[model samples]
Target: MKVDSVTEKAVKAVLDKFAESYARRDLKSAMSLIAPDDDVVIYGTGADEKRVGQEAIKTQFERDWAQIEDPGLEYNWISISAAGNVAWVAIDAVLKAKVDGQNLKFQSRITMVLEKRGDRWLIVQGHFSFPDQSQFFD
Candidate 1:
């Protein structure tokens, strides 16, 4: 079935808020977008970096914030689709910041899965990674 307009809007709003919160370094608002359940998972860019549950995710975010200064994120949605209570979003984003007294820029691809609980949608899973340059030549 095609995704209804309302569901699409709700999902987009959640994603937008998440991006905005992250760019602003508002840890609380960023955490609010994620589900509180212990099953929620986040796979980050670093090797072997996987965070399970809210507390783990929060700690990871705190570490990230501590390492960067003036962080900014620009997201371009590749696609968003919803079926009933579940939705997934794919996006390409550029993250800019200062890390360890040096400028850092990462072009990343991100995928997020969200589930609707009542009227609110919360991220249940998120994966973030830089595109592998090897794939371009294959």
Candidate 2:
């Protein structure tokens, strides 16, 4: 289904808030936006990491956040589309930080499917992967 401008804006709010939470490392606030039964998946060149449930997701994020210093994200682009009870959000962002005193940066493209539960939208599935710069912005 074609997503209206207002719906797009609302979805963008969620994405922006998520990015803000990452930049601030506010684990509690960040997880609050996610669905309770969210299935978070992270895939790159290495083994795929999958976490279920909000508690586990929060723990994983907190651990990961602890390892990085000066976390910031540059959201290159994001598109939100709706289909039935689910909202598909595609995002490209650069996660920048210093890991173990070494400058670390990577461009990641993330796709999240959020299912609407009553009046709130909760994430059902998440896919995150590191991609090349050329594959990012364009």
- lDDT by residue (30-137, candidate 1, tens digit) is 999999999999998888679999999999888878878988778865578888899988899988889878988889999999999988999999999999877776
Which candidate number would show the highest TM-score if scored against the true structure? 1
RMSD of 1: 1.7
Candidate 2 residue 123 Cα shift, in angstroms, is 1.8
Task: Summing lDDT over every window of 10 consecutive residues in candidate 1, give the lowest-scoring window.
Answer: 70-79
TM-score of model number 1: 0.91
CA lDDT of every candidate: 0.88, 0.75
The sequence of per-residue lDDT tens digits that candidate 2 reaches over residues 1-138 is: 788776677677777887799889998778867877544543322353566777767766777678789888789988789977778988888888889898888888888887777866766677777865465453
Model 1 regions lying over 4 Å from their true place: none
TM-score of each: 0.91, 0.83
Query: Ten residues in a row with the worst lDDT in model 2?
Result: 39-48
Q: Pick the candidate with the highest lDDT.
A: 1
